[model samples]
Target chain A: MGIHIGVDLGGTNVRAAVVLENGTVERLLQEKTEPEQGAEFTIQKIIHMVENLAEGRTIEGIGIGAPGPLDPHRGVILNPPNLPGWDEVAIVDQIKAHFSVDVQLTNDANVAALAEARYGNGRGFSSVFYITVSTGVGGGLVLDGKVFNGAQGYAGEIGNMILNPNGYHYSNLNKGSLESYASGTAIGKRAYELYGIKGGSEEVFDRLKNGDEQAQRVVDDAIEYLAMGIANLTHILNPEVFVIGGGVMNAGDLVWVPLKERIKKYLYPELVPMMNLKPSALSGDAGVIGASLLTRK
Target chain B: MGIHIGVDLGGTNVRAAVVLENGTVERLLQEKTEPEQGAEFTIQKIIHMVENLAEGRTIEGIGIGAPGPLDPHRGVILNPPNLPGWDEVAIVDQIKAHFSVDVQLTNDANVAALAEARYGNGRGFSSVFYITVSTGVGGGLVLDGKVFNGAQGYAGEIGNMILNPNGYHYSNLNKGSLESYASGTAIGKRAYELYGIKGGSEEVFDRLKNGDEQAQRVVDDAIEYLAMGIANLTHILNPEVFVIGGGVMNAGDLVWVPLKERIKKYLYPELVPMMNLKPSALSGDAGVIGASLLTRK
Candidate 1:
């Protein structure tokens, strides 16, 4: 068996792991993406990080899970919103040139979805939509146990799918999108508007739990939108499980309970009885696990 | 090669065709689906339509494409919105009892998606989302050349995917649904709100063409929403081709032109360049063609 390296390229951090066949992490390394210095600097950091992780080990290839809209076919980052100053950067070519190994690239969400479907909660399911509800809502779709890349490789960018027609203006979608209503950003925005107080998701969660009427209403509204979004997914994709991860999930049942209730209310009654709702088991590990599989057969 | 019979069960009509191996239709028949007569009667009508099309020819199996939420595994129609009074109808069993042939059933949208991917405009594409802008906006998703039925076989019901935040409330998706903005009923609704005229899609199209400014505006707004919906599909599903069908597309470029432009403006700029947007080639024939491929090994 050939050893492989997986890298999760995020706006804040670049994490690389050496994954064994049984989905174990043999070794792990972390570094900053620091994209402010430009694509060349980021590319160098990625190359050095991979080299450090390999450490003279017999590494067969490397797989990268990056924030999309990425050119997976070309291994280029096409102006991701989270990563500033990166515009169609050819990171794949840079990494391949340094290591002389094959590289596979995909959206971070899709990789996370692949990981969950193949090795974690999504196992045995023919179709799964893996959503990460963090600072932003991002997702990946797996069908028949493989990643589904839609036309032009933008298939799993569900966050960009508009949820509100008259809500706001966004580039990825029209006036409304799931991200506009369900993301942590949307929730925070709503909370800020409701109370004129700014705080992280945890603080808001506490306020809502304490029955701050305004805060509770805003949270309820947001959850309603989340349910609406999930209902939409239930109707369109009809996946067996919707694997939700992200920073907001740390709030636990405060979000999940209402979300499940709303989803049940909105989904087809027949589907509601058969749906399997689960939280992410891999958590932060999903990125590395999913990234690793990209290099697998 | 064994012959197969295809059936497209529409809200207004029931269409059936006998299909040969080379994707050719040998015999065609049409009938009205008197869904108001209840589930058993509708099932019998479907059976009669199939037998009439078969015309004593050797058919290996039968495929049905109907409006959902239907149970494809058990072959039951669970009170779909389009087909009234079709509650828990055992369509596959009903057909099988009469013909003694293998039977497979799926949502009309999903089957249409299969038809397009395999034998129509979606040729060579792995994932295709087919949206029909008719009396209501319905859709089908084809993944890897097969229908992608979700956990409860209720996948590809895009009409229920909400489009707005403060959108309307219903048993399914919110008012933000594409159906709320782009479907024929919605178009007429919007037109009525704008022009105070109560008519169907034909009147809306005629008034827009006859230089009625408000009517044109209503049509344009609908197109804008349609584009946004398509843009959402582009970003979310990322399918190669969004095959536009249904009564709304009958207006042709009147809808496609502005709709295409809006999608270009709203979609992820990176993805904007790689999409292949086309109207449906099969059109009225999609149901029959899709139904024919239902049981292919």
Candidate 2:
């Protein structure tokens, strides 16, 4: 059994953890990313954190989950939107040179999906499509226990998939993108527009539970679009399970029940019975743990 | 180098071929499937064809491309819509029992994609999404030189992907499915509705070329929807290239030029430069050659 190091590199913070072969966390460390100090400083901080964590341990390899537009094969982190001033940094090579260990890099969402597929609700499934309905819709596809990174490592960019090209237009994506309809940000925005009350997705869900007609309408609409996106995914991927995560999924049954019912309306009759939709079990630790699993044989 | 036997089993006919390791067709045979003759009769016909092809020759294995909804893993031909009585027939077991060679089965579209990826225009690409725009739109995803059969071997059913939930209804798929908008069957039906004339897709293309306004509108609408579907596929899969085949693609520049331009309008700017679209190079031979390639070591 080999021990591995996993790093979740986010815009606000960098988290590192030492994980055992059985998917157990041995030690954890967190620190501010401080991207304002530039790429060199950030890289140094990550190296120091990993060194401290591995001081008395035998580690096989390291995996880092970062925001994309990255060249995973070349180990180069391209200009990610949130990580300012970190343009074209060869983070894997730098870390490998410093630690004398193998390093692998993938997008954060993909790592989270890998985590779910390997250790969470999708543990026994051979294929899993993990979707995060947070501020923005993000997806990760795990096929045969491995991340299915298509050409250029941009396979699971499902947020940009157009749900209705004639619907509302988003600046970054085409009209009626899944992100514009199903994401928490989209729900919040739509809720505010309809009721003239600005609130997050949580507040909207609360209002729906209290039987607010307007809120119910807004949430129901989002659920419908979410189901549409999931149905489209089902037709394309036919994964064993769809493991959903993110802040909005915290609404629990309010989200899953309607979502499942709506998905059934669009799926192939033969496929409706095969649909296995579940909530994420690992929460925030999924990215770190999944990243570490990248180095696993 | 090994010689292989490839069988293409369609509703109306069965085609078998002897293929060399280099993807060259050495011998070919064609016969009516006559599926109404019963499953045992069809199995015997396939066995006889394979024996004829393998006479005085050494072969590695046999590969069959059949209408889907079949179990590729167990090699069982489920009751596909076209093959009326093919109710869970173990095609692989029967073929293997008759001949002392391994046998593999996959959906027809997937095998065609494999042929394109391994021996056609997609040879050097690591990922390929092959779409055939015949009577109904069908898709096959070849990732890392293999078919990406999802959990139940239903991975590349892109025809069922929804383009508009509010648009025209199709019995076999959800309302406003990609197939409903872009398939040849859909195009011809729309042309008939618009002009009160019944004609095939090729006749519509000819009318459009001959400066018929109604025909132009019908073809343009189809092109727009097809481009939208391709764009959605691009966002989700981001394959290295999109290899298009089938009769509708024979319209050449009228289809490809407008399609390329329309897809560019929907794709992310960064991804625009990364798009590599091409036409299938192997013509109708892809299915047989691809099925044979399945037996390659």
lDDT accuracy of residue A136 in candidate 1 = 79
lDDT of 1 by residue, A44-65 (tens): 8878877888778777889999
The sequence of per-residue lDDT tens digits that candidate 2 reaches over residues A3-42 is: 6999999999999999877788889999999988998999
Residue A124, candidate 2: alpha-carbon lDDT = 91
* Chain A agreement with the truth for model 2, given as TM-score: 0.96
lDDT of 2 by residue, B1-297 (tens): 446999999999999999888899999999999999998998899888988888857778999999878878889888888798779989999999877788999999899999999988889998899988888788889888888788777888888888887888865788989889888888888888878758777779889788888888888888898898888888777889999998888889988999999999888776788889899999677778989977777
Best by lDDT: 2
Q: Lowest-scoring 10 consecutive residues by lDDT in candidate 2 chain B? A: B194-203
Question: Clashes in model 2: which pairs?
Answer: none
- Give the residue spans of candidate 2 off by over 4 A: A1-3, A56-59, A84-86, B1-3, B56-59, B84-86
C-alpha lDDT of candidate 2 relative to the true structure:
0.87
